[model samples]
Target chain A: MPVTKMIEPILPVEKLTYLENFGHSLRAASYLYKPSSADEIFDVFKVAKQNHLTVTLRGAGRSYNDAALNGAGIIMDLTRMNKILDWNPETGMITVEPGVTLEKLWQHVLPDGWWPPVVSGTMTTTLGGCLGMNIHGKNNYRMGPIGEHVQEFTALLPTGAVMTCSPEKNGDLFYSMISGMGMLGVFTSITLKMKRVYSGLLRVKAYPVSNLHNHLNEIFLAAPDHDYTVGWLDATAGGSGMGRGQIHAAKYLHEGEDPDPQKTLRVEYQTLPATMFGFFPKASIHYFMTPFFNNPGVKLVNTAKYIAGLRKGEHLQSHAAFHFLLDYVPNWELGYGKNGLIQYQSFLPKETAEATWNEILTISQKKGMPSYLGVTKRHRPDKFLLSHAVDGFSLALDFKITIGSRDKMYAMLQDFDRIVLQAGGRFYFAKNSETSSETALQFLGEETVKRFKALKHRTDPDNLLESNLYRRVFGS
Target chain B: MPSTNRNSATPLKPGKCAIIVGSAKGLGGALARKLAREGFVLGLVDRNSELLVQLCAEINAGNVGQAFPYVQDVTSYEEVPALFQKILVDLGGLDTFIYVAGILLPTTPTTYDFEKDRLMISVNALGALAWFNVVAPVFQALHSGHIVGISSVAGDRGRVGNPGYNSSKAALTTYLEALRNRLSRYGVHVLTVKPGFMDTDMLKSSPRTFWVVSPEQAAEDVYKALRQRRQTIYTLGRWGWIMFIIRHVPSVIFRRLSL
Candidate 1:
């Protein structure tokens, strides 16, 4: 009996050194493997112990850098483990393997009058990755995050054993595993709490605000009563018209609101398009319709989009629109053309927002490139390891990606990062790409980092995994 | 850089979850995993989807906190607010929110660029304020939590390199001061982190620096400050001292110096 056959399906074991990352920008060459079972996971760990090879896990291949790419070690692919074991609508709980995508879970449970309690920005994110990341969704103000709703899970401990963890049993490991970002162990199957929904259609109101205060105070106050909410700040506007932008808030209107008899027969929220996962980024630049904005004046077209939104008969399909809204407007980012695109977002403490915004805008004038649009919103930070949220305001900007961008953006990023840090605020990692590693450590600290390394050693003592980001932050 | 036993040297274990907003591959990312090893979970918030998902998964395998990755323009009130609410349900609420999300415009010395100025303000100051409005109530209501913001030496006064960033940081510092004063009574600790020069991807992409500290080291300092609840912490410690003098410098002397 060769010890690697039955367990072989759990993980793909390949002795290669030059493993490239998801973004195709970072590469690590060592060993690659994909494990689909708990025993196989342990076997991979056992091999690493015997071979003294570092280890790292791979999911969906959605990460930008090297989180899933283990160099000079084993890259365990959890994709094949995708499975939905159990789902109970009454209890609002569902169980599945780590590889399950929120999209897949939607297909299994949405039709049964249940929805994943919360979803990340995208549908393709894996359940294990979601649990590892403790993802939050559009209804965060009321629902919180994915970790909050998780009831229990089975994670392969770094000690080469499978353990069950939750708030009650091995609660510490449960908390650690849910938000640990794979530092604690590999999650095999997890039971997630779900949410109740009345219908598949959502009625959204897109109203405009003129300044930051209203956007924060008025908008966030209505989170609980509303099922879904979001607002946009005009980064290009200022002075008396600070928050003069759009706020698009939505909620499921219930079946009675629509009164469509055809919708009454168990309207199942359709699964997201598979291509969406593969089509992560479609557009390059955030350019306005130059043809419309420039308007050569020769062609007369009646486009009243600048005035208000929606036509006479139009409502969004809750399941399809929210997750696939960007998909409908395909290649919208391409409007910026050759310059590419730049998307920026920042968060500041509530207290000094007015003054800090003034200073930042005062400085922004120096940069030749400026955003045409902006949006402001509120965020409540979660406990998931490196989450980015706080009691404050967040503003986003879109620009044409350009050549001097690195320098142009870094200067502002540095200043903005420093300001938020000093103001008892933090930045959003999802929207950033140029923050310096040194500054990154400053915000988190070195001691905490060391503990992370030690924990990794204790869990996977043999070091069988690696990722681009892992090497970047912990390689030394 | 040599590793430090963060708890022994400073304070705090590594089992908490930290939210780093501007953490794709810089200071925010460094702090994210640093704390992850410290036994803390990671919640990475950023607009860069590619970077956000990848980074979160990497950290997930290393720790137990179940790093959650959220993609939203931090500045977008609709996107981030909803994200936070979802996080509340997902991660079981707040432990710490590390505000590292920000953007840099061109460094020219002109205020005529209306668009650039607007972005600077929106991304730097307004976004920060929006986040605060949402989390303050949560932390205050819970009666315990921490709000850590990343500030800079440039914010002390109008800097020559980029006045927009200088002003943004200045505003952030002042805002946090006010927020700390208000939220302290409710058991929410507010920490202001200031670093002189950080060796992040941003710095690596730019000119080499002698004073720059690696993102990992910077992350350690942040964790230290959070554990100790140091209200106003400078990552390198010495940076605080350096800025102390710089802040008090009169306009005449300060403006005259090339620094």
Candidate 2:
């Protein structure tokens, strides 16, 4: 009788390293392996199964918390697998590898008069990560999440099964896995339907709003007419000025609107300037902004911005300039320092948005750790199983973390969660890091949580897929 | 680097490679000798150059198994990657990774020394995490390896006397449990040893002590557990029952007395 030998995968153990989230707040040590193909990913799964190590799927590590972190486990970095497989300019449909970033996708299709239907504030996020989190753009109220724009995807499960999922085929898996936070499987390829655009420019109008009521009202009213609308709140402002800020509403320019559509729609015109005023380097801007990360300094900057908005101006801005404001200054998040920053974003119903946000802002200021920056946007609910949207408004607040302020800040955030939950609000996993298991269950409902867990068990019988965020919120 | 075949007259018996971190003194040093006697090619690592060199020489002189000395500070997390790779190359192959490096600075409820508390957390908890991160993936790939973490019984409950020590152990204990959960499917054995009182400098500052055993005796228990593939164990055995009672004590009443 001939004996068959079992061969173990040859892992690159020297590749053990550290990985951090986008905000740089949460970090973990893991063995990072960049697999170039679905076959390599399968080998990784085989290795992880044999070694009893959980595997986390990572694309650009753009999450705000531990969603991409798996401590003392294996991190499968898909960035190397980036390749645009197919594109059809006529149909506005494109197929790309999971690691293809929004920046790469937009740059490739923009000259052809197509843009990603939805994108986050930063374009560096990967397609797999976006679908995993089901990110939304300023136009969320109109287009829904990026998942709604996805046509289909191929995923590799832990059970060594390759599944092709779409709305019509394996519908439950499609709806659940889109916002599943990379728990079900690894996305190998994604086919997305891009939004067709006539021109690159958007007619943007900026005006200042007064108090919490006007901020919410103005955005709700403007969203109906504009393709994209967002508000910047002066968190430092108190009393009648609470939630007072500026609103910028933008509308897409028709084909005939731009005198030279070819010139305006070119990638060169759509790209942000490499330098501010064409002299000072944009990459170094964050170092100078560091001095203003504190409460007093941010208050001064917010006041100046509000004062500048009082003039109420209108201008034509490119698509990149309008959508990717977070990337305007390179490494801008570094201004928050080594402790980094955490964002608390909540989605509330229109009926209770004003009242609930008012209480949250008041409590934040009262705690003496007011958020450095606040942004508000209108949104409509989607059908994703773990949706964080509502037919109302969403507020995102950025809090700078200091050596001694973490505990206090977390306590305050828990209080904010209580107020939001009472007002029937929901939380996004991609942002907020301090959400407790009970809060997740309350917002997602017992049925939804149970169903997601059931699907997870069925797909990953050995529980090979997991991340820090999944463990923290799901409490499994 | 030091190596010798002092027992050249006797046939050498080498089974598998094992690395004992903080093997310069105490339970770590004892465990190093025990594994060596069991024919494990050893990689003994510690920050104390003098003690580490002496231990390495002693092991080589015995010639039961070969030993390599690596001097490294456990708190220097960034340097772990290079040293980990070097140790793997020197050992040819690894089958067991034992993380016994730790520190216990005197802490009291009355005086809060941030520096001391920080050092304890750094060495006792975070340092272990850094080393474990390097070894886990290799073991997972091989599908057969042993990981042993030497935690303390102090982690069972938050005692008042040594706040930092108790909390660091608690964190380490919880982390090991999580690792066990993650690595169990691969047939990897993760052993968390929660020893009670051991005769070492670490416990000399305690207000009181009982059931203290020599490092040699404790090593015997640990080696037995490692061979048996036990998930967890309390050295001296009775500490398990004692901690059970201490853990269940209602906090409202347990707060009145220091264990």
Candidate 3:
């Protein structure tokens, strides 16, 4: 007798652990499916619909919190669906699958004298994730969020219908999906307009400032002329040196001045060894600096970094090297130990940015929860329904989570949220891990939240698309 | 083919040209499509003529680059040189040659069948060598080109699951290493790609599949490695460390473990 073989579906449901955006917290999903194509994703939605289970789409799992995690249902991991669908060099238009990372996109296009119009600090994030968050780069003040570069996209709705959306077609859905945080649907493909660059080199200049006022002034003055501008703040700097930092400004070098042609066109992605940060051992830093989660130790380290920045006045850098400085030290977050870290970013209007930032720094100093890392960038408003941008500035802070300071950290963040709300500021959902739904409602205005909720109800009527972040922030 | 300089600011006129064996399906087919999108004229060769013609039609439909199909069995070692000559002549030139044809036999050391073992050796080991014998000399004459061979991580160490398949890959790996050693002085690059478990037809029946990557992911990794001119790479890259640890395990302890 011969045995009869049974063939199973390519993607099978399996139990998996889900990590929050910052990797500080984790949960388990009842079922997880890693689909390699849009059709497979459609099957996943079908299964979710049939089983009456919610579905959450995850891409590269880089959202600092619960944006891509679903505690009670299924997770569709889209990392494997990465593919460059098409590229039209003459029009400077490129089409890519949702799973393609920014690093991959840049590498593919840079050699052809083209580049993405907007890119966030980390290059590992997926293009789909960037669109979901509507991420802003250092050049946000000049270029706006990544959504502005998007020409059109094909999205798979929860009802298993695929629709092509653009600014001119399906305009309502297009607006909602840009910053809808994946509540709208899953994007299968996106076509973006790319910017032309003569070379990958950037002419960089660093200006050190003493306080928040000086930092803002320098950024304001530098924004008009520079293509990219950002500030690195020393959160532990107190008293006379409050909010002190360095403002780094950069622009692409002209064709003739780009030093090495081979390097400028075909620059290889460079990575550091796990133990090496520049020449120093990162493991030694983690071991020796474990006890420095305190105010004074953090202050000393920040001061050292500030002095180092001051010494590096002017230099030429690869765009990747300049934009992805945080990734240079591999597993640097391990320095925070097992508890992980939390990142909180708030966007305030230009009129109230300086005052709100001063109060926020003062609050952090009083609470003695000095952020280990801080960055500030200018921005302008966009048309996305859940847009986080304002004609102002955003301050992002990273706090190391420790056993003793966890509660204090949450309380401090709550206080910060209150201050931000009082100043008419909004929060970035991509970086938030612990914001309450009430706070989220206030951060996004009541009317805007209502409109987004109504759109979600219409698009995902059965509410099949769900995530932990969605539950916490939208009360769904 | 066009003489495209990747480093130049000027765009490629007709783009680079590539010859990919076993491109009718699976990883090879995926790579062919990707290279086509990257503006590469393609020479797609496979034993399955039906799939080969269909794939060529699909790639040609895009009109990004022209796709030429050749039906030839890799195991027919003597026909490889002639096939290569035909592809080069049809495509005008070749800048990249990728060999992705290989067979996996279900033969353990104890239950091995002679025919399966022989077929595995012929397709997985000799077939790659046959292609290399023809392509390497042309690349050396041209003084500029890249050759990529898709081996497997299973070659890193011999195990009980399938000794014949593992040994064939081990042979391919060493052959590619020797080619790399000899070709570097001539500016001809040889890259050996050792992929972990990829979700391809070969692994459809395997029960112990873990950390399996999609074929598209494998193709993407291969393209990136070729761009960087890496000597060797592990697709889904973590497999490099996994194989490193597996290869360094003490023999006495390794014998007792089930792989």
Candidate 4:
């Protein structure tokens, strides 16, 4: 058999010094290939294999960490391969190339009264990234993660085998690739079961909660009736007001119930205004916010947000506006400065969520490094091999990176891991940057880790598909 | 011209039916692929019958949209009206008509060739006008359609390096503007696309070009501009400001600089 059928000349590998992720963490990669088609993807894999270079697949580079970055190796940028392969309105099945972003998918399908079953906080993230991380949304409790709605997918394995896998076909590979973080292969195409929608508006209600107990209680109470439920926790809240925040519950409006007179089935999704954050220099904003990155300033901002949420209790919003809250303030992460930011999201079982969440908050407050933003969401356990959900609640906290906060943040994360592991909780890989191998092994359990390792070995025996994240977490 | 019913009960899919001129290769081909992927039943026109047939087969195999190839050169101005009418009938209706058929001949002020200049002007300017003459009335009759013309940033000002190509693009841009002004009253949109240095075969031999975007990037910008109902756009966007400054330069200074 021919080792390679060279269609396009493999461009000379160039050194890229600053492959900065969304969170502003920079890494180096030896080569970057923007393959525009499936055949090109296969060629990329072959070239990587020939050169004995580990390949890391990147879609949109929105992972906030090293998940999409590979130090001194090839980075396969899949954004150019964006194309919708097929759409069947009768069955609500849409087949799309892996590079299609959620925004583009919504733009194509929403006009046809179809919506993605699950959408992450930002619409810029690609389908491939969602599948790789097995991302969950606010409605995860109802619709599950993106992987659950994925009917099938075709991936180019490191062995140069193009396999179509689904729940009914190539079942083992299907499960492995769902949350495999693109270790098993590069996804070429995905067939998703898009949910049908009657209108583009969402009816949302917000309630202010006092403490961790109230937050958990409100989420549990809202979960049964709401299609989507999520809460913004005030991390700076201490003592009596600890975990005080607002819980937002929403559902898609019926066909005729939308308040907008101009409402149509084909609503155009609005992008964030360029002037939304004002015309301040990004670096200057970061510098100004550095002093306010502490407990008191964050508390005041959270308090104001709480009051604003209370004032706007019930309202109608476009589906895009409701789901993509992060996009409203363009470059919001720039406020965290050049050192970047790290998000640590931990999921704990419902039985121990209240106490463990309190402990986590207390540790941050005591360290004087309280998180700037905290969000809570309910999740149901999924069957994917490396699933992060646990039929419980997950608290995601964002901490700014300061001059000497790396060691402090790592030390604090270690403490968090100990508490979470003791409480039978686990960490999310999408937002993780400093998770240790031992912590990951302990959190994932030995049997599951061993099984994943065996599968990884079978798919990539030569370790062709490797990333810095893979080495840090899995220790391959 | 066949008149499409404006009040038909069938809902308007955003980009249902599109006709792409010069759909055989480069930026035109990229746009054809993108529109098809976005669920537009396409009428692909090109002089290269073989490549057009291959593209149609590939698009059909992908199952994104139906592609119908029309192997008529745009230079044949008399054939465009009948060909467009046939395409409209075959595709059921029209929603978008993108004229991307253009040529760039290497003719400087000192080495001006009459044959090359005529070919460039006919293909890039008059050919676009031929398609617009046919398609604009159809879109007006329907009162709901997008007419896009791919002009060039070189159209912003004439340069000595390639005067023929620049003037041709300038004429196409002005024609598109006139069309937009006339079509606006009937709810029809006209977008003039001005792209800078794109990494296409057309620019393969061009030296020292900055901010070169891929055809895919240019195609994406074109699609976005269409969706936004923009009057005119610079693909990869920054070229707008670059051209703005270049257009405002004094003749004394401009004559001294070799762009």
Judged by lDDT, which candidate is best? 2
Error of 1 at B127 (Å): 58
| Residue lDDT tens for model 2, A255-277 | 68888888877999999999999
Instruction: Give the per-residue lDDT of model 1 (tens digit) for A1-476.
Output: 12221111111222333444322333333355677788888887777665544466767655433455543345677888988898787877899999888778876776666767777655667888777656555666666667888888888875767788878897656655665556568999898887766666667766655566666665676565677667655544546755445566667767566565235324343534334357744342223344432112101221233135322233565665675454444445455444334445666666765566655654554564445555565556666545555655666665444444544555675787677567666544334434445654665567655655666677655454443344444444
| Whole-model lDDT values for every prediction | 0.62, 0.86, 0.80, 0.81
B-chain TM-score, candidate 1: 0.87
Q: Give the per-residue lDDT of model 4 (tens digit) for A76-107.
A: 89999899999998888999998999999988
Task: Give the count of colliding residue pairs in each prediction.
Answer: 221, 2, 4, 0
Q: Residue B152 error for model 1, in Å?
A: 54
Report clash pairs, candidate 4.
Answer: none
The deviation in Å at residue B144 for candidate 2 is 27
Please state the error at residue A192 of candidate 1 in Å: 0.5
Q: What C-alpha lDDT does candidate 4 achieve relative to the native structure?
A: 0.81
Model 4 quality (TM-score): 0.62
Model 1 residue A98 CA deviation (Å) reads 1.3
Q: Per-residue alpha-carbon lDDT of model 3 for A1-476, expressed as tens digits?
A: 13323222222323433234545443333356889877888898887776556778888777777788664357888889799999987888999999999989988888777889999878889999999989889999999999999999999888778889999999989988989998889999999999988777788999799999998888888999999999999998988899899999999877777666566677463333445545777555656655765667788888998988776588877788888876665455667666777788999998899999898888887887888788999888989999889888999998777657765777788888899999989888888777778899887878998998898878888888877677767772
